[model samples]
Target chain A: MQSGDSLPELAPGDLPRQFTSRAALQQHLQQLFPSASGALSPIVGGWAAAQERLAAVDPGAYGRSRNHLAGAVTHLSPYIRHGVLGLAAVRDAVLGRITRRPEGEKLVNELGWRDYWQRLWGQLGDGIWDDQEPLKTGHPASSYASELPADIAGGSTGLACMDAFAAELRATGWLHNHARMWLAAYVVHWRRVRWQAGARWFLQHLLDGDPASNNLSWQWVASSFSHKPYLFNRANLERFGAGHHCQGCPAARRCPFDASYEALEQRLFAVTPTPRRR
Target chain B: MTAAPMTATPMNSPILWIHGAALGPANPALVAWPGRPAVFVFDDALIAGSALSLKRLGFLYECLLELPVTIRRGDVASEVLAFAARHQADGVVTTAAVDPRFRQLGQAIAARVPLTVLPVEPFVAPEAGGPQPGDLGRFSRYWRRAEPLVWQRFKG
Candidate 1:
C-alpha cells in the first residue's frame, strides 16, 4: 500500500503481533515512506517503558534544579504527552516516591501546568490560536511577523544561545523548559516574529509537542496570553545554561543579550507602561 | 433487593478508537475494555495540513507497534465508523481529549455511531463537591483550587 493510502489492510492473523526489531521496522518505514528519513529515534513506546521512565524521576532534584540546563528534569514528557503514561499515574508515582510534600509539589505543579493548558484549550477551542488577551508588549499585536525568518529556521541567527537551541531542537526533538522560554522570547520579542510562527516551528520538531501546551506556552512568552512578555539577559543564560554555548560563541564579547532584565524591559517595552489588564 | 430487567440495547461490543492523544496500552479507554479490537487512522489531510513532522509520525508508528491495533488512513470519523461496522461493534470507546479537533472528530463519529469517551486518567482531580472552575487563564489560581484534589484518589 502507498504511504498516504487511506486504508491499510490488516494481517489476517492475530492482534498485537510481535513487531520486528526497531532498526528493521525503521528501515522498512524509510523505504516505504522516504520523507520520514530524518534522525528519528524509535523511543521504546509502551506502558512498561513509560513505567521505567517514571520510576527514575527524582522529585527533589527536579524541584531544585529543573530550570537549569542540566537539571534533574523527568524525560517522561513524550510518554505522558502521547498517553503511554497517564498524567495521574505519573503524579502518583512522584507522590509515592517523595516523602516531603514541598519537594513533590513543584513537580506536581509543573504537571498541573500541563493540565491548565489543556483546560484552556478545551475552553478556548480554536481561539487558542488568537491572543487570549491583548498584547502588553510595546509593539502592536498586528506588527508581529507571521512567518519565521530564514535565519531562525536555518539556525544561522548570529546569536549564540538561539542558534544552539535551534540546532538542539532539530537534532534531539526536545529542549529544556527554560531553553524553550528563552528561545520563544527571542523569536517573538527580539526577532519580531509572531508566536504562531515559532509555535508551528516547534510543533514540527518536538517529540512531545501538543497544540494546547506548545501554542499556549508560545502565547505566554509573546505577552499576548500573559501580563508581560518574558525576556532574559546574558547573565541569566550564562548561569543556567552551563556556559557550553557561550564558550564557542563568536559573539561572546559583543553579545546581543549583554544588558540586564531591566534594560531589556525598557528596550522592548519602551513608552508602554508596565502592562495593565485591558 | 430488586434488579432492573435486562433490555436488548443496540450497543454491545465496544471498539477502542486509539486517538493521537491516547496511543498505548495505558489508555484508560483500553483499560476499561481490554482485549477489544482497536483502530488507528493516519489522517493524511490532517498531517498534510499541520506542521507535524516526519519524526513525530515515526514516533507514533513506534507507539502503535506496542499495541494490538489495526492501523488505517483516511478521514478519521469515516474510517473509525467503517472499522466498527466491520468488527460488528455496537459502539466506539475513546479516551477523552481536550483538543477541539478531537472533539469535532468525536461528534462526527457520534453522528454515525454510538461514541463513548473515557476521562483522561491520572491528572489533577476536580474540586470535591465544588463546581468545576472555569478560570484557566493562570496556573497559580487553578493550582490553588486543584492541589488539594490532585491526589485524592491515590492509595499511597
Candidate 2:
C-alpha cells in the first residue's frame, strides 16, 4: 500500500494516492475532511478486498443462518452499494456457483431488496425520505420525538445490546441485519424517537447509507411501510444473539424487552380495534 | 486485451465523471470508454451539510485510490466541468445515479458541455413488453413480478 506514495506523483493538488499505513491514511483524511470525525473502519474498500469477500460467500449457509448475529452473511453491501461490485455481477457469481434454486434463492432474494430499494428511489426521487404509507403502530406520527436522544447517539444507553449496536455502528460503519432491526425498533418504539432522526443518524455513519434502503427500512420498523411495527423480545434476542448481550447485562433484571409480544403490544402501542362483522 | 487510448482517436471525446454512486472499475462509463481520463469529486455540500464521518469519506477515498481516476473535492459540478476543460472534453459521460443531487449536477455540467448518462445493468430487467417497475407499493407485489424474471437469467 505504501508503494504508491513513493512514486512522487505529478498531478497538482491531487491528494496522495497512497498511504504508508492505515494510520497514515487516517491522519491524512482527518486533515482533508476535518468536519468528518472518527477512526477508519477495519473494513478495507477496494476490488481486491471485495473480490476476496465475494469468493467466501456461501449462499446456502447465508440463507440458513443470516439472522444470527454471527451468521454467514455476506459483507458485500459497502462494495455493492458503491458500485465496486455491480448487483448483476454478484448475481452471476451466485448463479454460477449454485447447483439448485434453494441454495441461492434467499441470497438472490436479499439482492432483490437492494434492487427494489433502488427502483423505488428512481420512482420516488427525493420522496424516499418520506413515509411510504400511514403508520400502523397505533400512535400518531407526532407522538415520536423529532431527534435522537443524546444517550442513544452517544452509545451510552444502559441497555447493553442497544449500546453495543450504537458503538459498533460508530466504530465500524456497519451493523448486522438483526442488530439493525433491534436498534431501529428500540429507537422508534422504545425511545419514541422519529424514524427520520434515526435514519439521518445512520446515513451520517453508514458506509452503505443509500437513503432508499436506510429510510425505507427505518419506516418499516416504525410501521410506516409495513403491516406492523417490528419488535424483538429479550427471549428472541437471547435466542438469536446467543446470550451475548444478556449474559451479564446491567439491565438484565429490568430489561424492557423482557415482556411477551402480547404484553408489549398492549403496553407500547395504542391498539385501535377493528369493527366486528355484523 | 487490445484497445487504444481514446484520446488519440478523437478530439473532445467525453471524459468520465465518477461520482459517489459509481466508484468502481466496472462503472458503465469507465467500461464504455477505456483509458478515458476520469475525475472523482467529494461533494462539498454533502460533506459539510450531511456531516459525513471519516469512515464514509475514508472508505470512498480508498475506493477512488484503486481506480485510475483523478481525485478532487469541492462543488461536484464545478470540479467535473473543470476536469472536462482540462481534458478539452466535448462531453461528460457518467453512470446514472439515483441521487437527485447527481442529476442536478449532471444538468449543470450539460449546460456547458454535452453529457451522456449510461444505465446500470439491472438486477432484474423488466419482463419483455411488461409493466415498468409497476406496483412498487409493496415489495411482495414487486417480487411477484420480478423474482421469476431474475431466476430466468440464472446460468446454473
Candidate 3:
C-alpha cells in the first residue's frame, strides 16, 4: 500500500525462496500463511499444462451439461484467472473444435460473463465492494450478518450438499460455475451472511477467485446486483446435484431445502415481483 | 480517440512487473517484452494483513518457477521502484488490471517511471457497432452486443 518514500519496513528474510516442488512450496507457505482448516492440493502449473487442459474442453458437452454436478466444465478457470492461458487463446481453442458458431455459443457466452465482470470492476473501481443496487427482495441489507457462521465455514452445516461444496472448495481450490452459484445463494440468502463475508472466504480459498468476478457474482446472488435473490430447492438440487453429494448424504431426510422453488420463494420473499424501472 | 498501443520494442532496459493476476508466459506484458527481467513481489503489507491463503501463495510460487521472474517481498510499489532502480531500468511495462488495488499501484508506478500498460488478450472482441457497457446491466444485454464479433474469426 505504500509508495517509495513512505514504504514500511519489511521483515527480514521476507523474500520467497526458490521452490523445487509444489509440496515444498505449500509447506513453506503454510509456515507463513496457514489455511483455515483443510488445505488445497496444488493444481497443475505452467502454460504447457494450461494449454493441454484447454485442448481437452469439449464445447458441445460443456453446453449440454455444465449445470449438472457431473458436467464437461472446462477446468480452465484457474489458469485463465491466473493468466496462464490468455482469454483469446481459450476462445480460439473452443472455436476451432465446433463446426458451427452456435455450438460454442454457450461457452463463449460464459467467457463473456467473466469479461463483463472485469469491465464492471474497471468502471466501478472500489464500488464493486459495495452493493451496486438496492435489494429487490424484502430482506433488508442491515439484517444480514457481516461474518460467516462457524458451522458453515467448518463445513458442518448439517446440509449435505452445502457441506460437500465447502469441503470440495477447501480441498480443490475450485468449483463448477453452477456449484459456485448454489454456494453463494446458500450463504447470502439462506444463511443471511453478507456478500462481502462469503466473497472474502471464497477469495481466500478459490484459485480462480477474482474480486471482480467473485465478488460481483456474490452480489448478484444476494439481490444486490440482480433483480431477485437467487434461490434453489431440493428438486433443483436433485436434478443437477444428485450424484456425489446426495449419494450417501446422512442429512437426506432432514434436508432444509426439501420444498419446491415456488414455496421457498413465497416463504423467503413473500411479495410480487419488483417491476424494473426502465 | 484512444492512444495507439505502446507495443514493447527491443530496448536496452525494460522491466516486467508481474503481480497476482499477471503471472505467466502468456502474460501480454511479458509477451510484449520477452526476455526482460520480470519481478513478482509478494507485497508484505498486503499479504500479511489480508486473508491470502497458503494455497494461493503456493500456486503463485509454482507459476513463478516456470518463468524467469525474480520473486521479492515487501511493499509492492516500493519494491518495484527499488527493483527498477537497482537494475537501472529506463521503463516498466505490465498487464492492465481491473482490480482497484492493482490499478492504484500501477498509477503510482506510472507517475514515477515510464509504465506501459498493455491490454489483456480478450476472449471475445466487441462488434464494430454495439452498445457501450454502461448501457447494459445484465449479462444477457452485454452478451447481445459482444457475441457477434467475439468469436468470429477474420478471413484473410
Q: Pick the candidate with the highest DockQ.
A: 2
- Order the candidate numbers by lDDT, best to worst: 2, 1, 3
Task: Report the lDDT of model 1 for residue A140.
Answer: 82
Lowest summed lDDT across 10 adjacent residues in model 3 chain A is found at A1-10
Every model's DockQ: 0.37, 0.46, 0.39
- Pairs clashing in candidate 3? none
Off by over 4 Å in 1: A1-20, A31-37, A272-278, B1-10, B129-131, B151-156
C-alpha positional error of residue B12 in candidate 3 after TM-score superposition, expressed in Å: 3.6
How do the residues A144-214 of candidate 1 rate in per-residue lDDT, one tens digit apiece?
Answer: 89999999978898778999898888876788998999899889888888899999899888889988899
lDDT of 3 by residue, A1-278 (tens): 11122222333443554556556666666766553334535576556668778878999899888888898888888888887777777777777788887678789888888778877877787788899998867778898899999888789987888898888788878888778888888887677789999998898888888888998888888888988778877777778875557767888877767786666767666454532211
CA lDDT of every candidate:
0.75, 0.83, 0.74
The top-ranked prediction according to lDDT is 2
lDDT of 1 by residue, B1-156 (tens): 011121223456978889887876777767788778788887767776774666677677777766667876668888889889888998888887777778788878887777777776546545464215555658777777787787564445
lDDT of 3 by residue, B16-105 (tens): 888777666778867777667678888766665556766666666667666767777678888898788877898888887667788778
Model 1 chain B: which ten-residue window has the lowest total lDDT?
A: B1-10
Q: Provide the TM-score of chain A alone for each candidate, in the order shown.
A: 0.88, 0.94, 0.88
